[model samples]
Target: MGQHEFSEGVEVSHSQYGRGCILDMIASQTGGIDDARVLFYLSGEEVTVPTYSLAPASEVTSVESTRGTLGTTVTIDDGFYTITVEPDGEGTGYNLSLQAGNAILDQAELSSDKLF
Candidate 1:
C-alpha cells in the first residue's frame, strides 16, 4: 500500500462494511507504512484492513453506519498474542497493530468504498 493521509480522529465508511472508526495504525520504526496496518471497529467487531484500500468517509446517511466509539489505549491478551487498541483524538481514529518483535504480521486501513 502507498502513503495514506488521514487524521487520528475521523470516521471511515466502507463500501461493504458500512461505517466504522479507525482504531489505530501500526507503522514501521521509521514511521513508514510499508508493512503498516490499521484496526477498524465496524459491525461490533475489530477488523484489520490493508492501507491500500482506504479512503475518507463521506458525509452521507446510511443504515449500516453506527456511531463509532472512542476511548484510550485498550489492551487485550489472548494468551498467545497481545492486542492493543488506542482511539484517536476524542472522535474516533486511532492506531492498531499486530507484530512480533521486528516483524510485522499485517496492516489495515479505512476508506470510502467497498473492501472486497
Candidate 2:
C-alpha cells in the first residue's frame, strides 16, 4: 500500500516460496499495492503474493546500479514495464521514460536546479 518500500528488481524471500525476484507490483485503482508478482527461483514460476508477505533477501551480497553517459541510453526492462534513461536532446538534462506494454506511463526531463 501507499508507495511500496520495495521496488522492482529487489530480491525477496517468502516464508512459503523461498527466494525470488520481484517482477512487479500490481497497483490498485487507489494507487496502492494490490499484490506482487514474484518469480520463485526454485519453481521458475511467477507467483502472486501479498506485498506484506515478501521480505528482502538477506543473502544478497552486492548490487550494481547502471547509469547512462551522454549520447547513450540505459534501459531496465522487467516483464511488466520498461524504464529508459537517455541524454536529453537539448543537453540540459536526461530524459526518463516509464512504459508498460505499448502505453507510456510517464516521461520526464530530469536535471538538477543547482548551479555548480
Candidate 3:
C-alpha cells in the first residue's frame, strides 16, 4: 500500500498570478499528479487556480514557518474565485478563496484503478 500525504489550506504562489493559498488537493494515483485547488483575491476579485501551475514562495524569499515557510501561487483556472492571504503579525488565520469547478459526484470514481 502507498501512503498518500494530502493537505488542505496550504500556502502557494504562481507565475502569471502573485501569491495565494491552497483550498484543497486532488491526487491521481496513476499519473502521480497532485492538483491543488487554490483561491486568490486580487483587486477585490477572486480567482481559482491549479497546483501544477503554483510555484513555491520560499523559493522566492525567506520566511519562518513550522512547515518551512513554503509558499506557492496557483493560476486562475476559473474566474469565479479569488486568492488572498491574511498575514497577522503573529502569523495565523490564513484564508484562501476557491471558485466552484467540476464536481466529484461519486467517491467510487476516485478509487477506481482505471484512468478512463
lDDT of each: 0.49, 0.73, 0.45
Per-candidate TM-scores read 0.36, 0.46, 0.37
Q: Model 2 reaches what TM-score against the true structure?
A: 0.46
Tens-digit lDDT track for model 2 on 13-76?
A: 7777777888988987887777889998868999999888776775322323465455666776
lDDT of 3 by residue, 1-116 (tens): 11233256655556666556666766678765457666654433345554567665444433223332433323333332333333322333343444333432222111122335
Global Cα lDDT for candidate 1: 0.49
Q: Can you rank all candidates by lDDT, best first?
A: 2, 1, 3
lDDT winner between candidates 1 and 3? 1
* Shift in Å, residue 52, candidate 1: 1.7
Best by lDDT: 2
lDDT of 1 at 39: 43
Tens digit of per-residue lDDT, candidate 1, span 1-116: 12555544555655455456666665667876532233444357666665555555553321221234564565543222344455554453556655533455665533223245
Model 3 scores what on Cα lDDT? Answer: 0.45
